[model samples]
Target: MNSEEQPILSIRNLNRQFGSGCRECGGGSGQLIKNYCLSCGTVYACRDLSFDVFPGEVLGIVGESGSGKSTLMKCLYFDQETTGGEGYISTYKDGNANLFAQSSQEKRYIRNHLMGKVYQNPILGLKMDFSSIGNIAEKLISAGERNAAGMEERGMELLTHVSIPVHRRKEAPRNFSGGMQQRVQIAKALSNNPPILLLDEVTTGLDLSVQASVLDLIKGLQRELGISIILVSHDLGVIRMLADRTMVMLDGKVIEKGLTDQILEDPQAAYTQQLVHSLL
Candidate 1:
């Protein structure tokens, strides 16, 4: 593909602000921001952020909590409305089209048809009360794949792909271990056959061994499905293992961005260097 045809997602000058009142709080101010809780005043979560995700490439975003990685991803995926700037997600065979500027109906079409998301907390993505396989099939049907047999077939395939036992397909996710729950979440995220997958701190609560396995599973899926992915994580090791490119964020801005090896081995920014060093 030509350069113009390469990128599946592009973001430019993206900004998001959260304020308690109508007045916007500038980025310089210190404030605590929560996902659902907007404080008494506004807080800037992202500022002039820009990046791209190429077709079939895995881009890793690394930063401490409150650095705006999650917020940026959320905005790109249209989970949250943007305060300013532009973002595009490729929907047609021709090239990328602006997503942020689209009408609500248009954005909804792209989100449901082309994008899938996995949250840091696995339960947020999977229904704890439903059987693991049931949740996966539900996503398939919701995506408009109406054939019940097809949904069941794909659901079982995904469960096996994640190494969940066939017998456990009928068991509720609440009874599974943390790692198992995450595996089921992955299955659900893949149910829609989305071209882009946004993963937020996917392995956060899993043990080291489980983390390694899950990372391996993601890599394998990427190779097999050829879907573009943006993964946000605090774990440098996860970034090093999964990302071809890495972007480091600090204080609601992108401080460094480059190939994963370049950023890890010879970081130029002080904050980037500090983050790399902290991993050692």
Candidate 2:
């Protein structure tokens, strides 16, 4: 790939504002507030956001609760619709076409074939009633892999990859510990070997040790598979462990972005400084 090549993913001026603009709220723009609209009771869960994730790089998005980080991830994976913006996935249109302009079927294909996600809550990522193997199979099935033997083999390989014993492949996630369940979720997400992965607060509810192990697993996967990843986390520790570059968000806007070392050692934004200080 050329050094000047476009980003694997690019988002331009993404907006996901709720409620119609009103005069009292400055038409829902121009520094009216962070999220809520005093005029029309609107919410801007995402607002005028733009960034890029380069191939084989981990782009960390860090923000506190209600900072619109999760919302941005959802929009990237098409879990939620964008109010306005242009998104491009290089694998789809050589990084020139807008992703939101694609048909529903096209979007689904991109999501299924090009992207993978591990939700913070295992429940969102795993089916409680289904066996661990079955959950992995579901994703394989979505991507049109129909051979039962192949699915089972891939599922087993993934389970082992995440450090889940193959013996428990037939058990449901609900039967496992929180960390094990999360491992299963990671297994399921990687079943298809998608090039891009989205991880949303993936270690939030786990214990410190568990969190370390999970983060290590992710780092290993990135190194081994060379997958481009968008990692959304409020925890600076998580960001520091995984991210090559970082984007700091405050009130639905990016306040600072640079290499992980730069953000941690020499933050520019006041909010980022406050955040880094709290970590000490």
Candidate 3:
């Protein structure tokens, strides 16, 4: 990663909370019960989180369930509204504009053009009834492609790039295996050629062999495309395999961050130490 190069994506003080806070827990002054306010019953799913994704680098976010990793992804993708934050994309308005503050139409444009996301649940990212290639076309169309032949050609190229059989391109993702569905989702996500890709627990729940295959595919694609990616996973093994840099989150806050190798060799945080040791 080139430290001198500008980050492709930068997030500042990103915060997402589920409820209005009370006097005690408002403004992040008071806290109780692991990111929850007992008095107000508010959940601070993400708080004052900030990070950057450099060009062609995979930034991993590792955390357990309720660690706010997934919530952070949702905020970045605009799947959920953020309570407060600023996001800058180098390719968007020359990185001068704050993406979180953009108009809804503008956000949609950014989502369709500047970034792609692969959700852990294929249902969230794919239309089950749509053919696999049709799913790719959907994204391409959203990005302003109008020529049917052009879109189909792009879709076929992407599916083949992701190693999905050309013969199965016409089948719905529902008809494919778990790993195949993910491949289709990947192909669809890449259809628009977005600079940034957000992947959330993509390998979770797959069989061990399938998980390895999916991870291998991701590694290969990242190298082949040189696309920047933000990968969210609870498994440190997954992060270690793909992340150039990593941020560890707990209870809605980042407790550690560094190059993946440094974090593994010398984890400063106790929680991070345990996480690294578990892979031994």
Tens-digit lDDT track of model 3 for 1-280: 3543889999999999998999889666586688999998899999899888889999999988999999999999999999998999988998899999999999999999989999999999999999999999999888889999999898889888888989988999998888999989988888888999999999998999999999999999999989999999999889999999999999999999999999999999999999999988
List the pairs of residues colliding in candidate 3.
none
Candidate 2 Cα errors over 4 Å, as ranges: 1-5
State each model's C-alpha RMSD to the native: 3.4, 1.4, 1.4
The TM-score measured for candidate 3 stands at 0.97
What are the TM-scores, per candidate, against the unseen true structure?
0.89, 0.96, 0.97
After TM-score superposition, the amount by which residue 237's alpha carbon in candidate 2 deviates from its true location, in angstroms, is: 0.8
Model 1: lowest-lDDT 10 consecutive positions? 22-31
lDDT to native, each model? 0.84, 0.89, 0.92
lDDT of 2 by residue, 1-280 (tens): 6833568888999988778777776645644657788768878888788998888999999999999999888888888898899998887867677998888898888877889998888898889999999999999998999899999999999999999999999999999999999899888888888889999999998899999898999999899999999999999989999999999998778889999999999999999999999998
Ranking by TM-score: 3, 2, 1
Alpha-carbon deviation at 210 in model 2, angstroms: 0.7
- Give candidate 3 misplaced runs (Cα > 4 Å): 1-4
Q: What does candidate 1's lDDT look like per residue over 85-187, in tens digits?
A: 9776666434455678788887766766788888888777888998888898777776667888888888899999989998889999999988888889888
